[model samples]
Target: MILPFFVYGTLRPGERNHDLFLRGRTLGEEPGRLRGVTLYEGPGYPYAVEEPDGAVSGELVTALPEAYPGLLTALDRLEEYVPGDPRNLYERVVKEVVRDADRAVVRAWVYVAAPAVAARLRARGTPVGGGEWRERR
Candidate 1:
C-alpha cells in the first residue's frame, strides 16, 4: 500500500542505520508512537514485541515516491524479514501510529519481532524501559 514506515531502534533518525538506509530517501520524518508493543534489546539493535500494555516511541518516515520500492526492499532485508518465514527475525506489518505533532492516527509499516523472536524476548529479553530505544539505559 506504500504506507509510511514506523521506525524504532537503529532505523530512527541519527541512529546508525538511518544514514545507511533512510538518509536522502525519505520525504519527511516525524515523531510517532506505536501502541501495543514493547521495545527489547537485541544484539546491537532493538526489537519491538507485541504486548497489549506497551507503547513504542519512534518516527514515522514517509519515503519519497521513487524511493518507496527500494526502501521497502532494503528495510525488509535490513530487518531480516521474509514473508511468512519461520526463521525471520522480524515481520513487517501494518499498524496505526499516532503522530506526535498532530495526534493524528496514521497507518504505517512496522517491523516487529517475529513470532518466535517475540516469544523468546517475552521470556528473557531485556526490555528498554519507557518504550524508547534511544532512552534505554
Candidate 2:
C-alpha cells in the first residue's frame, strides 16, 4: 500500500525544490491545515512544532511506498535533512496532517529547523507564519 504525506515547505509552490521534487507524479494535492502546531521559518525551510492553537497549511500527496525512499532523499537535499544532527537545515518527522477534514494516518515527513535556528532567523527579522504560504489549497 502507498502512503499519504502532507508537504508544507519547499515542495509546496515556488519553493526551490518544488519543481525538482514534486514536479510530476502528484497523485493527490489538497490545501489542508494541520491543527495544534506552530510553523516556523528557520532560513530556507519551515518547521512545525506542537502548539495548542496553531497549525500549518500544506498539501497532502499520496505516493507509492517503493518510490518514497528516493523522494525522501531528494527532499533531504533540498531541506538539508540530517538525522541526529541539530545543525542540519531541515529535519523530518512523522506527523498527522489533516486534509479536507479527513484524517489520513500515514508516515509523512515534514521539514523542521531547530529552535536555535528558528530563533536566529527570528532575531534577524524573519518569522515563519502559522499559516503556510503556497499550499495546495
Q: Which candidate ranks first by TM-score, i.e. highest?
A: 1
Model 2 bad stretches (over 4 Å):
1-3, 13-16, 41-45, 101-107, 118-130, 135-137
Instruction: Give the per-residue lDDT digits (tens) of candidate 1, residues 1-137.
Output: 99999999998888999999999999999999999999999999999999999999999999999999999999999998889899999999999999999999999999999999999999999999999998875
RMSD to the hidden true structure, all candidates: 0.6, 3.8
Per residue, candidate 2 scores C-alpha lDDT tens digits across 33-106 of: 67766676545556665556877788877654566777766767766667877687555666666666566444
lDDT of each candidate versus the true structure: 0.95, 0.64
TM-score per model over all chains? 0.98, 0.72
Alpha carbon deviation, residue 131, candidate 2 (Å): 0.8
| Most accurate candidate by lDDT | 1
Kindly give the number of clashing pairs for every candidate. 0, 1
